[model samples]
Target: MFFTPLSLLSGLSPEWQLVVWSLVVTVLISVPFFVRHFSMQAPHEVTPFPFLDLPRELRDIVYENLIQNPSYPPCTPSPKALSRFGWLLPQRPAPSTSNWVMLSNHQVYEEYMDLLCKQAKFTLTVDQKNAKERDIWPIRSETLKQIRKCDLRLVTTSKMLGAEDPRTMPKDWPLRDKICERLRGVQKAEDLNLHVRAIGDPLWNPLWVWYHASQAFKDSAKPCFQRITFSLDTWSPGENLLARNKEGQWEWRCRENHFVATDAGQYLIREFCSALYAECQDCPRR
Candidate 1:
C-alpha cells in the first residue's frame, strides 16, 4: 500500500523498472557513508595538557628555566606609521613577548606570579631623557612589593657637578631629585646594585650623590636591604678608585692618595658608607 518512486516506474517495462529500483537502492546505501565522511572534516577542540598534575619540584624547575631574562617587547613603528592626519596615536605598553606561559590559565598564573617577581632580576635604565616619565617601567605596586633584587643603572653627565669641587653642586639639583624619586620606587628590595657611568671626560666622585640619595631613601621610605654595592665606570687610571677585584668583588681603593687628598672627598666617602651601611650592615663592599 505504500506509494513510492517504484509506482512511477510501474508504467515502464520490467527491465526499466528494475533499473530504477537499482538506482534508488544504491543512493540509499551511500547516504549514510557520505554523511559520515563529510562530518569528519570539521575541526576538533583539544583539551589542554595536565601540567599542574606534575610534582611541585618539577613545576619549579619548569618555571625557573622559562623565567630567566625574558625578551623585551618590540619597539613602536616610525612616526609616519603611527600618525593619522598629522595627529599622533596615544602610546601604550608594547606587547610583551616573554613569559607568555603565565596567561595559560588562572591556576598557572597563581603558581608562577610570585616566582616571576621574586627570582628574576629586573633591570631599569634611567637617564634625563626618559626619567620624567613613569620611573618603574611597566611594574605594578603588587609586583614591586615582592621584588628582591634590582640593578639600577644611572647615566649621568659630568657638567652637572664639577669633578674638582663637590662644594659647588646644588643640594636640590634636578638630576638628584629624579634619582631619589626612582630610588623610592624600589625601597622594598633586599639587594640593590647601583652602577654609575659618565658620558664625558674627568669622571666626578659620585659618593656625594649616593650619600644624599641614601639619606633621602631613609627619610621617605625607611629602606631595608641586605647588601648594597656601588660601581663606577672610570676612564682615567687615577679615577679608577673602586675597581672590582679578580674575584668579582669590590676592592676598597678610597684610601689612595687621590681620594684622601681632598677633605671634601674624604667627608663624602665616610658619609656615603655610613648612610648605606647603617641600613645594610652586610654590604659586600665592607
Candidate 2:
C-alpha cells in the first residue's frame, strides 16, 4: 500500500501527530538559514546582458556602425597664439563620439582598439608651423603599434602656416626630415602614403619636388614601411578629391599631373588590384 502523508498522519495518535507537526515546523524554519549560509560561501554569478551574448562578428559590426569619423576644425588663429606668433594654429580633431564605447572596461576597450588600429586605415594631418600645438601621431603608442597602414597628409603651405616666412617655406627639406624621424617610431606600420599639399612654383619641377619629399621616408631600419606612395595635391576646389581607379588604387586627382608615377606607385596600385580581385573572388556578387 502506498502511504501518502495524509494516510500516515491519519494513522498517528493525536499526541504523536502534534509532535510530528512541531518537528516539521522546526525543520522548515532552519532550512532557509542553511541555504543562506551555503549561498554566502559560493561565488557570485553575473548574468550577461543580451547584447554581450551576441556573436563576435555581430558585435564588431555594431561597434563599426557606432564609430564616427572625427571632425576637423578649419585651421584658424587662436587669439592668444595670433597675438604671440601672428599665425594660425593647426587644430586637432574636435572631440567626437568615435571611441566612446572603448571607455567602458579594460577588456572591451582593448578589443575595440585592436579592431580599430589593426584593420582600419587612419588619416593623419601634420602642419609644419603648428607642429608644437598639433600632434601628428594622435593614437597612443600601444595602439599605434597595431596599425599596419597610415596616410600622412602634410600641409606645409604658407596659407595654412599663416605666414610668408622664408624659413617656413614649403619646399624646406628639414620639415619632411623631422616628420620622417617622428614616423620612424611607428615600427609596426607596413605601408605609409604621403599626401603633400604645397603651393607649387612655376619654376619648380613637380616630379623632383615630390621625389625629394618622399625620399625622407625611404628608411630601411625602424618603422620601415614595405611600400610607400607620394602624391601631390594641387588643392583644386570643388572636385572629387579622392577616388579609386580601374586598378583599385586610390588616386588624388589634381588639375595638373602633380604625381610622377614611380615604381613605388605602380607597386601600390598592383598590390591594391590583387587585394581587390582576391576579395571579389572570395565574395562574389549575389
Candidate 3:
C-alpha cells in the first residue's frame, strides 16, 4: 500500500524509481573517484606557439637585455670580425662597454637568443664577457622553474647561426662541423617570469627549415590554451624566415619570405594602439 501511494504520487513505476534513486546515489558517491582517476592520467605534450609576428615588446627583449643595458657589455669582435664583413651583429645590440668587434663566440649569458637576433636583426649586446655570472647564467631555482613551464630547446643549428651554407659544403657530407644545444632561454637570460621565449632550432615544431630564427609558445595554464593548445588540432601553419642549405642545417632568411610580411605604414602611435587593441586582445603590453 505504501509503494502504491508513492508510485501514484511520483507517477513512476516502483522499479523505475529505484533505478533513478540508485543512479543519483552512485553519481554523488563516485564523483571523487572519477576526479581522482582523471587526475592520475598523464598530461599530454604540447606543441610550441609561433611568435614570429608578435608585438615589439615580445620580439625586442633580446635587444633590451644585451644592447640597451649599459652594464651588459658587448662581445669583442675579432680583428677579422665577421661583423665587419656584414657577417655579424650591430652595435645597437650590445652595451656601450662592448668592443664592437670577433671571430670567437661573444660570451653573452643569452647565447642562442643573442645569436638568433644577431643573425636576424644583425646585432649583439657586449663583446666583453665581464658581467656577473648571475647575468649570464641566471638559472636560479626560481627562473628554472619558470623556463621549465615552457618547452625547452637549443639553437646552434648552423643555418640559424648564419655560419654554414650547404652549397659551400663537400658533397661527401659529415665532414662539416656544426654545434647545437646548451643555451638556456628563460632562466638565466633575464628576469621576466612569464616571458615565454626559446633560443634554439624550432622550439617545438619538428617540421621546418628556417626553424631557429623564431619560436612559438603557449601558456598552457591560460584559459585560451589549457587543453586545446597542446593538441594536434591547435597546431597551425607557421611562417619560417630561413632557407635550409645543402649542409642540412636551417638558416635564417630575410622577413620577405614569411607569411605575414611587415609593410611600411605610417600612423600616429594612438591609432596604432587602437588598432592593436582591436586585434590582439591577449597581448600583455601596450
Best by TM-score: 1
Spell out the clash pairs found in candidate 2. none
The lDDT of each candidate is 0.53, 0.54, 0.32
Tens digit of per-residue lDDT, candidate 1, span 131-172: 556553555656656667766555555554323455555455
Pick out the ten consecutive residues of candidate 2 with the lowest summed lDDT. 275-284
Off by over 4 Å in 1: 1-47, 70-98, 158-167, 174-188, 201-286
Residue-level lDDT for 88 in candidate 1: 47
RMSD of each: 11.9, 17.2, 27.2
TM-score of each: 0.50, 0.47, 0.18
Q: Show the lowest summed lDDT stretch of 10 residues, model 1.
A: 257-266
Order of models, best TM-score first: 1, 2, 3
Where is model 2 more than 4 Å wrong at Cα?
1-50, 68-94, 133-135, 158-174, 200-211, 219-221, 225-286
Q: Single out the weakest 10-residue window by summed lDDT for candidate 3.
A: 223-232
Off by over 4 Å in 3: 1-74, 81-95, 98-154, 157-239, 242-254, 257-286
Error of 1 at 145 (Å): 1.3
Between the candidate structures 1 and 2, which one is better when assessed by lDDT?
Answer: 2
Top candidate when judged by lDDT against the true structure: 2
